[model samples]
Target: MKKDIFIPKVENVYIAVVNEYNEIYNSQDWNAYIINNKDVDLEMVLIVTSGYNEGKITSTFRKKLERLPAKNYAKIELMQEELFALNNTFKVSFFEGNTMYDKTFLFRKNTINLKALQPIPLMDVKGVLVK
Candidate 1:
Protein backbone atom coordinates (compact mmCIF):
# COMPACT_ATOMS: atom_id res chain seq x y z
CA MET A 1 0.00 0.00 0.00
CA LYS A 2 2.87 2.38 0.70
CA LYS A 3 4.13 1.89 -2.84
CA ASP A 4 0.71 2.68 -4.24
CA ILE A 5 0.87 6.33 -3.24
CA PHE A 6 1.38 8.73 -6.12
CA ILE A 7 3.29 11.86 -5.31
CA PRO A 8 3.57 14.54 -7.96
CA LYS A 9 6.83 16.29 -8.47
CA VAL A 10 7.00 20.00 -7.82
CA GLU A 11 8.34 21.95 -10.80
CA ASN A 12 9.25 25.59 -11.45
CA VAL A 13 8.54 26.68 -7.91
CA TYR A 14 11.45 28.14 -5.95
CA ILE A 15 12.61 30.19 -3.00
CA ALA A 16 15.09 32.98 -3.63
CA VAL A 17 17.03 35.33 -1.41
CA VAL A 18 17.56 38.73 -2.97
CA ASN A 19 19.57 41.72 -1.85
CA GLU A 20 18.16 45.00 -2.98
CA TYR A 21 18.27 48.62 -1.92
CA ASN A 22 15.36 49.56 0.31
CA GLU A 23 14.15 52.97 -0.74
CA ILE A 24 12.42 53.60 2.56
CA TYR A 25 15.33 52.56 4.77
CA ASN A 26 18.00 53.85 2.40
CA SER A 27 19.97 50.65 2.89
CA GLN A 28 20.37 47.32 1.21
CA ASP A 29 18.31 44.48 2.66
CA TRP A 30 18.03 40.77 2.15
CA ASN A 31 14.54 39.52 1.36
CA ALA A 32 13.06 36.12 0.66
CA TYR A 33 10.65 35.49 -2.18
CA ILE A 34 8.53 32.65 -3.51
CA ILE A 35 8.47 32.16 -7.24
CA ASN A 36 5.73 30.32 -9.05
CA ASN A 37 6.74 29.61 -12.62
CA LYS A 38 4.05 27.11 -13.42
CA ASP A 39 1.23 27.73 -15.86
CA VAL A 40 -1.40 27.19 -13.13
CA ASP A 41 -2.08 29.08 -9.95
CA LEU A 42 -1.24 27.81 -6.48
CA GLU A 43 -3.84 28.09 -3.75
CA MET A 44 -3.53 28.27 0.03
CA VAL A 45 0.21 28.64 -0.14
CA LEU A 46 2.13 28.19 3.09
CA ILE A 47 5.77 28.77 3.94
CA VAL A 48 7.71 28.13 7.13
CA THR A 49 11.25 29.41 7.45
CA SER A 50 14.08 29.15 9.93
CA GLY A 51 17.84 29.25 10.33
CA TYR A 52 20.14 27.04 12.33
CA ASN A 53 23.76 26.15 12.95
CA GLU A 54 25.78 23.98 15.33
CA GLY A 55 24.61 25.73 18.48
CA LYS A 56 22.44 28.57 17.23
CA ILE A 57 18.90 28.59 16.00
CA THR A 58 16.70 31.43 14.86
CA SER A 59 12.98 31.89 15.35
CA THR A 60 10.65 30.01 13.07
CA PHE A 61 8.63 32.19 10.72
CA ARG A 62 5.36 31.17 9.19
CA LYS A 63 3.73 32.92 6.23
CA LYS A 64 0.63 32.22 4.20
CA LEU A 65 -0.86 33.48 0.98
CA GLU A 66 -4.35 32.98 -0.35
CA ARG A 67 -3.16 32.51 -3.86
CA LEU A 68 -0.05 32.79 -6.01
CA PRO A 69 -0.68 33.47 -9.65
CA ALA A 70 1.15 31.65 -12.37
CA LYS A 71 4.43 33.06 -13.66
CA ASN A 72 4.59 35.42 -10.73
CA TYR A 73 6.27 35.83 -7.38
CA ALA A 74 5.70 37.25 -3.92
CA LYS A 75 7.96 38.46 -1.11
CA ILE A 76 7.93 36.14 1.87
CA GLU A 77 10.05 37.84 4.53
CA LEU A 78 13.03 40.03 5.28
CA MET A 79 16.21 38.16 6.12
CA GLN A 80 18.60 39.78 8.53
CA GLU A 81 22.29 39.74 7.67
CA GLU A 82 23.06 37.85 10.86
CA LEU A 83 21.05 34.87 9.67
CA PHE A 84 23.44 34.42 6.76
CA ALA A 85 25.91 32.61 8.99
CA LEU A 86 23.48 29.77 9.60
CA ASN A 87 21.73 27.31 7.34
CA ASN A 88 18.40 28.77 6.23
CA THR A 89 15.48 26.58 5.27
CA PHE A 90 12.08 27.16 3.68
CA LYS A 91 9.29 24.61 3.79
CA VAL A 92 6.64 25.22 1.18
CA SER A 93 3.20 23.63 0.75
CA PHE A 94 0.39 24.49 -1.58
CA PHE A 95 -2.45 23.17 -3.65
CA GLU A 96 -2.49 22.92 -7.43
CA GLY A 97 -5.96 22.13 -8.70
CA ASN A 98 -7.15 19.42 -6.31
CA THR A 99 -3.72 18.03 -5.49
CA MET A 100 -1.27 19.09 -2.80
CA TYR A 101 2.44 19.64 -3.37
CA ASP A 102 5.24 20.12 -0.90
CA LYS A 103 8.92 20.99 -1.21
CA THR A 104 11.81 22.00 0.98
CA PHE A 105 14.41 24.53 -0.10
CA LEU A 106 17.62 25.21 1.78
CA PHE A 107 20.57 27.58 1.73
CA ARG A 108 23.64 26.11 3.34
CA LYS A 109 25.54 28.06 5.96
CA ASN A 110 27.39 31.15 4.69
CA THR A 111 26.02 30.78 1.18
CA ILE A 112 23.60 33.70 0.95
CA ASN A 113 25.89 36.34 -0.45
CA LEU A 114 26.31 38.56 -3.46
CA LYS A 115 28.90 36.25 -4.97
CA ALA A 116 26.38 33.44 -5.19
CA LEU A 117 23.69 35.46 -6.96
CA GLN A 118 22.33 34.57 -10.36
CA PRO A 119 19.39 35.68 -12.48
CA ILE A 120 16.15 34.50 -10.89
CA PRO A 121 13.18 33.26 -12.84
CA LEU A 122 10.32 35.79 -13.33
CA MET A 123 12.43 38.46 -11.67
CA ASP A 124 14.77 41.05 -13.16
CA VAL A 125 17.34 41.09 -10.37
CA LYS A 126 19.98 38.52 -9.54
CA GLY A 127 19.85 36.56 -6.28
CA VAL A 128 20.72 33.30 -4.57
CA LEU A 129 18.32 30.49 -5.35
CA VAL A 130 17.70 27.66 -2.93
CA LYS A 131 18.34 24.17 -4.27
Candidate 2:
Protein backbone atom coordinates (compact mmCIF):
# COMPACT_ATOMS: atom_id res chain seq x y z
CA MET A 1 0.00 0.00 0.00
CA LYS A 2 1.12 3.57 -0.61
CA LYS A 3 -0.14 4.62 2.85
CA ASP A 4 -1.77 7.62 1.18
CA ILE A 5 1.36 9.71 1.37
CA PHE A 6 0.87 13.47 1.19
CA ILE A 7 3.32 16.34 1.55
CA PRO A 8 1.98 19.03 3.84
CA LYS A 9 2.16 22.55 2.44
CA VAL A 10 0.95 25.70 4.15
CA GLU A 11 0.04 27.25 0.84
CA ASN A 12 -2.55 24.55 0.34
CA VAL A 13 -4.76 26.04 3.03
CA TYR A 14 -7.77 27.99 1.82
CA ILE A 15 -10.87 29.89 2.95
CA ALA A 16 -14.59 29.21 2.45
CA VAL A 17 -17.96 30.31 3.69
CA VAL A 18 -20.52 28.16 5.46
CA ASN A 19 -23.79 29.34 6.83
CA GLU A 20 -24.84 29.00 10.46
CA TYR A 21 -27.87 26.88 9.63
CA ASN A 22 -25.84 24.64 7.37
CA GLU A 23 -27.66 26.30 4.47
CA ILE A 24 -27.17 29.26 2.21
CA TYR A 25 -26.70 32.44 4.20
CA ASN A 26 -29.27 35.20 3.94
CA SER A 27 -26.76 38.01 3.71
CA GLN A 28 -25.57 37.23 7.23
CA ASP A 29 -24.44 34.48 9.62
CA TRP A 30 -21.78 33.27 7.26
CA ASN A 31 -18.62 31.73 8.66
CA ALA A 32 -15.13 31.74 7.24
CA TYR A 33 -13.37 28.42 7.00
CA ILE A 34 -9.70 27.52 6.73
CA ILE A 35 -9.42 24.20 5.01
CA ASN A 36 -6.20 22.27 5.51
CA ASN A 37 -5.27 19.59 3.02
CA LYS A 38 -1.91 18.61 4.40
CA ASP A 39 -0.38 15.49 5.85
CA VAL A 40 0.48 17.03 9.23
CA ASP A 41 -1.58 18.74 11.91
CA LEU A 42 -1.26 22.50 12.33
CA GLU A 43 -2.06 25.30 14.72
CA MET A 44 -2.47 28.74 13.27
CA VAL A 45 -3.38 32.39 13.63
CA LEU A 46 -5.70 34.00 11.08
CA ILE A 47 -5.92 37.76 10.62
CA VAL A 48 -7.93 39.63 7.99
CA THR A 49 -6.28 42.75 6.59
CA SER A 50 -7.73 45.37 4.26
CA GLY A 51 -8.76 49.02 3.83
CA TYR A 52 -6.89 52.06 2.43
CA ASN A 53 -3.53 53.60 3.27
CA GLU A 54 -4.56 55.25 6.52
CA GLY A 55 -7.63 53.48 7.86
CA LYS A 56 -7.10 49.76 7.94
CA ILE A 57 -9.75 47.11 8.36
CA THR A 58 -8.61 44.88 11.17
CA SER A 59 -10.38 41.72 12.28
CA THR A 60 -11.66 42.10 15.79
CA PHE A 61 -12.15 38.39 16.20
CA ARG A 62 -8.47 37.57 15.63
CA LYS A 63 -9.42 34.00 14.74
CA LYS A 64 -7.15 31.24 15.99
CA LEU A 65 -6.82 27.63 14.95
CA GLU A 66 -5.82 25.40 17.84
CA ARG A 67 -5.72 22.26 15.80
CA LEU A 68 -6.26 21.71 12.12
CA PRO A 69 -5.85 18.00 11.64
CA ALA A 70 -4.63 16.55 8.41
CA LYS A 71 -7.23 16.73 5.65
CA ASN A 72 -9.62 18.68 7.81
CA TYR A 73 -10.95 22.19 8.41
CA ALA A 74 -11.78 24.87 10.97
CA LYS A 75 -13.69 28.11 10.73
CA ILE A 76 -14.37 31.56 12.18
CA GLU A 77 -17.66 33.40 12.55
CA LEU A 78 -17.16 36.01 9.84
CA MET A 79 -19.99 37.46 7.86
CA GLN A 80 -19.59 37.42 4.07
CA GLU A 81 -21.45 40.67 3.44
CA GLU A 82 -19.24 42.52 5.91
CA LEU A 83 -16.10 41.91 3.88
CA PHE A 84 -17.49 42.60 0.40
CA ALA A 85 -16.98 46.36 0.71
CA LEU A 86 -13.21 46.18 1.28
CA ASN A 87 -10.34 44.24 -0.17
CA ASN A 88 -9.61 41.39 2.23
CA THR A 89 -6.76 38.96 2.63
CA PHE A 90 -5.86 36.42 5.24
CA LYS A 91 -2.43 36.54 6.86
CA VAL A 92 -1.89 33.08 8.26
CA SER A 93 0.91 31.81 10.47
CA PHE A 94 0.78 28.14 11.24
CA PHE A 95 2.98 25.58 12.96
CA GLU A 96 3.30 22.01 11.79
CA GLY A 97 5.45 19.75 13.94
CA ASN A 98 8.37 22.00 14.97
CA THR A 99 8.40 24.18 11.88
CA MET A 100 6.56 27.45 11.23
CA TYR A 101 4.82 28.49 8.03
CA ASP A 102 3.40 31.82 6.88
CA LYS A 103 1.37 32.89 3.88
CA THR A 104 -1.43 35.16 2.70
CA PHE A 105 -4.50 34.28 0.65
CA LEU A 106 -6.64 36.84 -1.11
CA PHE A 107 -10.28 36.53 -0.16
CA ARG A 108 -12.47 39.51 -0.88
CA LYS A 109 -11.11 40.59 -4.22
CA ASN A 110 -10.57 37.28 -5.92
CA THR A 111 -12.76 34.89 -4.03
CA ILE A 112 -15.33 36.55 -1.81
CA ASN A 113 -16.80 39.09 -4.17
CA LEU A 114 -20.43 39.22 -3.07
CA LYS A 115 -21.28 41.19 -6.19
CA ALA A 116 -20.18 38.45 -8.55
CA LEU A 117 -19.57 35.29 -6.53
CA GLN A 118 -21.64 32.23 -7.19
CA PRO A 119 -21.89 28.83 -5.57
CA ILE A 120 -18.72 26.90 -6.15
CA PRO A 121 -16.96 24.18 -4.23
CA LEU A 122 -13.16 24.32 -4.13
CA MET A 123 -12.52 21.44 -1.73
CA ASP A 124 -14.22 18.72 0.26
CA VAL A 125 -15.89 19.66 3.51
CA LYS A 126 -14.33 17.92 6.49
CA GLY A 127 -14.96 19.33 9.95
CA VAL A 128 -12.58 19.61 12.92
CA LEU A 129 -12.68 21.27 16.32
CA VAL A 130 -11.34 24.84 16.20
CA LYS A 131 -10.40 27.09 19.05
Candidate 3:
Protein backbone atom coordinates (compact mmCIF):
# COMPACT_ATOMS: atom_id res chain seq x y z
CA MET A 1 0.00 0.00 0.00
CA LYS A 2 2.83 2.35 0.80
CA LYS A 3 4.41 1.75 -2.57
CA ASP A 4 1.13 2.47 -4.27
CA ILE A 5 0.71 5.84 -2.62
CA PHE A 6 1.86 8.76 -4.68
CA ILE A 7 2.94 12.09 -3.29
CA PRO A 8 3.81 14.78 -5.74
CA LYS A 9 7.00 16.74 -5.25
CA VAL A 10 6.66 20.45 -4.67
CA GLU A 11 8.73 22.69 -6.93
CA ASN A 12 9.16 26.35 -7.79
CA VAL A 13 7.69 27.47 -4.49
CA TYR A 14 9.82 29.15 -1.83
CA ILE A 15 9.84 31.20 1.34
CA ALA A 16 12.14 34.19 1.48
CA VAL A 17 13.09 36.79 4.06
CA VAL A 18 13.89 40.24 2.77
CA ASN A 19 15.31 43.30 4.43
CA GLU A 20 13.37 46.23 3.02
CA TYR A 21 13.64 49.89 3.79
CA ASN A 22 10.69 51.31 5.71
CA GLU A 23 10.25 54.90 4.69
CA ILE A 24 7.90 55.67 7.53
CA TYR A 25 10.20 54.29 10.19
CA ASN A 26 13.42 55.22 8.45
CA SER A 27 14.83 51.79 9.23
CA GLN A 28 15.26 48.47 7.56
CA ASP A 29 12.62 45.87 8.27
CA TRP A 30 12.71 42.15 7.83
CA ASN A 31 9.75 40.68 6.00
CA ALA A 32 8.64 37.29 4.82
CA TYR A 33 7.28 36.49 1.36
CA ILE A 34 5.84 33.52 -0.48
CA ILE A 35 6.89 33.03 -4.07
CA ASN A 36 5.00 30.88 -6.53
CA ASN A 37 7.05 30.26 -9.62
CA LYS A 38 5.04 27.39 -11.01
CA ASP A 39 3.08 27.74 -14.20
CA VAL A 40 -0.16 26.67 -12.54
CA ASP A 41 -2.15 28.45 -9.88
CA LEU A 42 -2.32 27.20 -6.31
CA GLU A 43 -5.67 26.97 -4.52
CA MET A 44 -6.52 27.12 -0.84
CA VAL A 45 -3.00 28.13 0.08
CA LEU A 46 -2.20 27.94 3.78
CA ILE A 47 0.95 28.90 5.62
CA VAL A 48 1.86 28.40 9.26
CA THR A 49 4.92 30.20 10.55
CA SER A 50 6.75 30.08 13.83
CA GLY A 51 10.15 30.65 15.38
CA TYR A 52 11.87 28.82 18.20
CA ASN A 53 15.17 28.39 19.99
CA GLU A 54 16.52 26.77 23.14
CA GLY A 55 14.18 28.37 25.65
CA LYS A 56 12.44 30.95 23.51
CA ILE A 57 9.52 30.40 21.21
CA THR A 58 7.56 32.89 19.22
CA SER A 59 3.85 32.75 18.57
CA THR A 60 2.67 30.74 15.61
CA PHE A 61 1.04 32.58 12.74
CA ARG A 62 -1.46 31.19 10.27
CA LYS A 63 -2.20 32.80 6.93
CA LYS A 64 -4.55 31.74 4.20
CA LEU A 65 -5.06 32.78 0.61
CA GLU A 66 -7.87 31.68 -1.62
CA ARG A 67 -5.54 31.45 -4.57
CA LEU A 68 -2.04 32.39 -5.59
CA PRO A 69 -1.52 33.05 -9.27
CA ALA A 70 1.31 31.45 -11.14
CA LYS A 71 4.60 33.31 -11.46
CA ASN A 72 3.65 35.72 -8.72
CA TYR A 73 4.45 36.45 -5.09
CA ALA A 74 2.82 37.75 -1.94
CA LYS A 75 4.04 39.19 1.33
CA ILE A 76 3.60 36.86 4.28
CA GLU A 77 4.50 38.89 7.35
CA LEU A 78 6.85 41.33 8.99
CA MET A 79 9.55 39.66 11.06
CA GLN A 80 11.14 41.33 14.01
CA GLU A 81 14.90 41.51 14.25
CA GLU A 82 14.88 39.42 17.40
CA LEU A 83 13.42 36.44 15.57
CA PHE A 84 16.66 36.23 13.62
CA ALA A 85 18.25 34.48 16.59
CA LEU A 86 15.75 31.65 16.43
CA ASN A 87 14.91 29.03 13.87
CA ASN A 88 12.10 30.28 11.67
CA THR A 89 9.87 27.73 10.02
CA PHE A 90 7.21 28.14 7.37
CA LYS A 91 4.87 25.26 6.65
CA VAL A 92 3.00 25.70 3.39
CA SER A 93 0.17 23.59 2.03
CA PHE A 94 -1.86 24.10 -1.11
CA PHE A 95 -3.74 22.35 -3.86
CA GLU A 96 -2.88 22.26 -7.51
CA GLY A 97 -5.72 20.85 -9.60
CA ASN A 98 -6.86 17.85 -7.57
CA THR A 99 -3.50 17.19 -5.92
CA MET A 100 -2.39 18.56 -2.59
CA TYR A 101 1.21 19.54 -1.91
CA ASP A 102 2.97 20.43 1.29
CA LYS A 103 6.42 21.76 2.08
CA THR A 104 8.33 23.21 4.98
CA PHE A 105 10.97 25.87 4.62
CA LEU A 106 13.26 26.62 7.51
CA PHE A 107 15.79 29.32 8.24
CA ARG A 108 18.18 27.96 10.82
CA LYS A 109 19.04 30.08 13.81
CA ASN A 110 21.20 33.05 12.91
CA THR A 111 21.00 32.21 9.25
CA ILE A 112 18.82 35.15 8.20
CA ASN A 113 21.32 37.94 7.84
CA LEU A 114 22.53 40.57 5.47
CA LYS A 115 25.51 38.52 4.35
CA ALA A 116 23.24 35.73 3.18
CA LEU A 117 21.10 37.89 0.89
CA GLN A 118 20.73 36.68 -2.69
CA PRO A 119 18.51 37.33 -5.68
CA ILE A 120 15.06 35.86 -5.11
CA PRO A 121 12.96 34.38 -7.89
CA LEU A 122 9.84 36.34 -8.86
CA MET A 123 10.89 39.22 -6.64
CA ASP A 124 12.88 42.37 -7.22
CA VAL A 125 14.85 42.35 -3.95
CA LYS A 126 17.56 40.14 -2.57
CA GLY A 127 17.07 38.00 0.51
CA VAL A 128 17.65 34.64 2.16
CA LEU A 129 15.80 31.87 0.39
CA VAL A 130 15.05 28.44 1.81
CA LYS A 131 14.08 25.81 -0.73
- Candidate 3, residue 9: Cα displacement in angstroms equals 1.0
Candidate 1 versus the native: TM-score? Answer: 0.96
**What would the per-residue lDDT of candidate 1 be over residues 36-125, giving only the tens digit for each residue?**
999999999999999999999999999999999999999999999999999999999999999999998999989999899999999999
lDDT of 2 by residue, 1-131 (tens): 56785434566666665544444544435566776766777876555544322355654456776788888766656665556556555567788777777766665433444343344233443222121
Q: Write the per-residue lDDT of candidate 3 for residues 14-124, one digit (tens) a residue.
A: 999999999999999999999999999999999999999889989999999999999999999999989999999999999999999999999999999999999999898
TM-score of 3: 0.95
Clashes of each: 0, 0, 0
TM of each candidate vs. truth: 0.96, 0.61, 0.95
Best TM-score among the predictions, by candidate number: 1
Q: Higher TM-score: candidate 1 or 3?
A: 1
Question: Model 2 Cα displacement at 39 (Å)?
Answer: 1.5
